[model samples]
Target: MINYRPKVFDEASKSHASKKLYAILLAFIVVMGIILILESIIPAIVSTKPMLEEMNENGYLENPDNFNFQESMKLAMKVSSSPSAMIPTLLSTIFGTVTAIFYCRCIEMRPVRSMGARKEGFFSHYITGIITGIILMSAITLLSVALGVNKIEICHGVNYKVIALYLLGFIVQGMSEEFIFRGYLMTTIGGAGYHTGIAVMISAVAFALAHAANPGFGVVPFINLTLFGVFAALHVVVFDNIWGICAIHSIWNFTQGNFYGISVSGSNNTESVFRTTAVSDKAFLTGGEFGIEGSIFTTLILSIGIASSIYLIYKRQQLQQKKQPSQE
Candidate 1:
């Protein structure tokens, strides 16, 4: 029998699937959904961070009745900004960890993991992440070229230090998202059932839809984002862990935004270490309105991602099975 302990309801130390698992998932999704809908209606409902309210309480947002569109956009963006580190950490532990423990109540997982107090560490799985990110970025870049939306000029410049810094920024961006989504969300959902297909699909959907509000919203980007979800879910199934996928996501974004200097998902990354000027003609290749991620090549890359994830997962399973009889 599989031994699992989700810290949601049971007082006993004995391992058993928590009865509250489904109820918890359903309730949280519904609540999050409602909150999102309300946010669309009233911008102030957007983020849980109190900073916006504090700003408004001060003269930062006085009689906005006299403000123009740009001012309004700034306010709207502010409402959705991230919270202070202390608050987010408190919430992640109280909320994010709880979701992880409960949502993935299906799998026989460890009550405590090697991921420690810092909530981060040396990415042992960093290599796999970089490969995955590179694959995705390459595909997107190729499509950008074909579409003529923008062109890229690779720098053979002697400024290797700038290039290195740019790459590091990319790594951080990919790692952060991967860690949060694939690592955090995936393992949490594993408790429900680690080896099953359904758990993976759920994670992927969550990953994709999270980007719905990004500046460029068309069918392709949405589809691409959904594919990202699928990619992330499958990635975790391979290692039965989250570290690799996090690095991939952070690096992927960093590369797309910083190094390429092309619009990343339609948003320009002027803050990136390297400044890249647009260099293409065909909007289709340029990914036109949606950015490189909006291209069909992105789909191909995702297909590869899906295949790689499956292959890795199968190999891991085989290794585990091979060890099982020896233990016996």
Candidate 2:
């Protein structure tokens, strides 16, 4: 059974955070602004050199009139694959975590633990989360391969160094997102006297919409993203801490992109351990440009996860009630 500690909400209630939707909206703006500024800094500084080199090779720089949009896009994709170019993009996500923490601690006057940064049981929770993430992502990839939705082949001469860099980046990237969405936004909303249900749903939808601009994002992908957000939120509430979900998010992305060689959320392919090549023509099964995260198998796994989380929450609630004496 899961532990249902409502410490976040209880603390939020005592704080002077904005009421209802304002907390969410304000938090959204602040977090987004901070993240955008931080994410742009390194990329803008370092990525320009690669782009210039690509442009020079393609003669786009020498002859501005002959600039080809298609070729430029390909150049961008190629540059994005370079570890030196992309690692900074991933690492910059730390600002998201910092931004959320700052807003909560300073702006809202809430303690860090109230944002689900509880120090107790962090290691065990994080390890369990890592295993759970691997299992979940592996299930999607293996099922796709077994059913002929996709095929996998060993990526020879794989750059383990590059993949390690990606792992580091994903650690920050995933934790940043969870801290912003689940820790800050969701908790803030719930702390403002709103129903936890409302807080969860709103944060989940916001998370989905945040990715609407990704390539190959469609109706089904939107649904899946929202479901993922819900699953992450439930995990947060069930465990009453962000460490597990943070690890899960990091492992999920790392396993998808670097371990199984699948595209991560419509992003371009990077160095991976195994290359998952598409064999089927069906976009629904193989997820087209969105990668395995958009596949039907993902839907199934996330649904099971959500159901399990709900069951755990219910069981925890029952256990909590039993622990309390009757109020007759």
lDDT scores in order:
0.53, 0.87
Stretches of candidate 1 exceeding 4 Å from the true structure: 1-21, 27-71, 74-124, 146-149, 154-176, 272-285, 315-328
Per-model TM against the reference: 0.62, 0.94
Candidate 1 lDDT score relative to the true structure: 0.53
The collision pairs in model 2 are none
Put down candidate 2 lDDT per residue, 1-328, tens digits, no spaces: 3335467877766666668587468667767877778877987787788899889988888898887777777787778767888898899889889988988888888898888998899999999999999999999999999998899999999989889999999999999999988998888887877776777888899889888877789988888899999999999888888999999999999999999988899888889999999999988898889988888999999999999998988888998788787753
Error of 2 at 125 (Å): 0.6
Write candidate 1's Cα lDDT for 153-188 as tens digits.
654443455445545544544444454455444444
Evaluated at residue 276, the lDDT of candidate 2 is 96
Of the candidates shown, which would achieve the greatest lDDT relative to the real structure?
A: 2
Give the poorly placed runs of model 2, Cα more than 4 Å off: 1-5, 68-72
Per-residue lDDT, model 2, residue 219, is: 82
